[model samples]
Target chain A: MTYGLFSKFPAQPGKGDDLADFLLEAAELLERDPACIQYVVSGSDEPDVVWVFEVWTDQAAHDASSEPEDIRTLIQRAMPLIAGTPEQTQLVIHGGKGLPS
Target chain B: MTYGLFSKFPAQPGKGDDLADFLLEAAELLERDPACIQYVVSGSDEPDVVWVFEVWTDQAAHDASSEPEDIRTLIQRAMPLIAGTPEQTQLVIHGGKGLPS
Candidate 1:
């Protein structure tokens, strides 16, 4: 089963760019992980919010990625720029155009 | 440039399955649209919520899709199952694994 994650990060005043940059850089790290199917980082219409949509092979794959040093480092860098708690939704992908069918 | 959309639908009590089914069926309709780069419909951890993540070639493609009769019909079918106002985020895809580079 594919594990999908949708998360919203509201950046602190004037810190939106910083958060976006951090996420873009983190995408590189995720790309190297075979378990990562898709990791899209986007800038929303709302100036202060950044959205992350991700797909992993499974729950374990996602958990393993979080334990990596690079991801931990990036999280630390991004944490201060976030204005408030992130809103997250975890889902199971039934079928999608991008995923392996 | 790609136009991305992340929308959440919170289904009315006992209408979760109906919402999921509607979205899954809608995915098939979207597949035939060339402008739709990717459209993934998912069922979330919250029983009553469904998440839709979409990528389009551009904003015009997205707009044109909304004007179609088929899509309009689906929207009508889905409206009754929804419990509250949908939360939507529109974004510009800077770079993503699933999108064409």
Candidate 2:
């Protein structure tokens, strides 16, 4: 089954752009990983919030994606910019446009 | 620039599956729309919540999507199954895999 996740990152005051930059960097990293189907980083109308919509080959692939040292280092760098605990909605993708049928 | 939206639909208790089905039907309807880039519907960990992640060629394309009679009628059918007002997060998509570069 295809795994999906919608996550919200609330940046520290005036740090929204910083957080988005970090995620865009992550998107670049994931681009090389075949297991990553989509890693779309977006900015919401809420200035302090950044959202990431991810579709992976499966749950295990998503779990292993964060284990790389580079990714871990990036996460560490991103932590200080976060204002609160991130929120995530785990999902089962039903498929649509842009997804592999 | 690409347009994106992440929306949450809270279904009445026991209507989760029904709402998901309706959204899947919408997905089918949208498959014929050239402006609809991605319209992914998902069932989340929250049993009563359905999430939709959409990407369009532009904001105007997205806004015009529901103007069609078929889509408007589908929305009306979906409303009764919903438990409360839906929530939407408007987005400006930067770029990612599976999206036009």
Best by lDDT: 2
State model 2's lDDT: 0.90
Q: Over the stretch B3-95, how does candidate 2's per-residue lDDT look in tens digits?
A: 998889999999988998899899889999888889998997789888899999899999889898999999999999999988998899877
Q: How well is each residue in B1-101 modelled by candidate 1, as lDDT tens digits?
A: 78999888899998988898888888788878888888888887688888889988898998888677988999898999999998988888777565556
Q: TM-score per candidate, in order?
A: 0.86, 0.91
Clashing pairs in model 2, backbone N/Cα/C closer than 3 A: none
Give the TM-score between model 2's chain B and the true chain B. 0.93
Q: In model 1, where do residues sit more than 4 Å from their true spots?
A: none
DockQ each: 0.66, 0.74
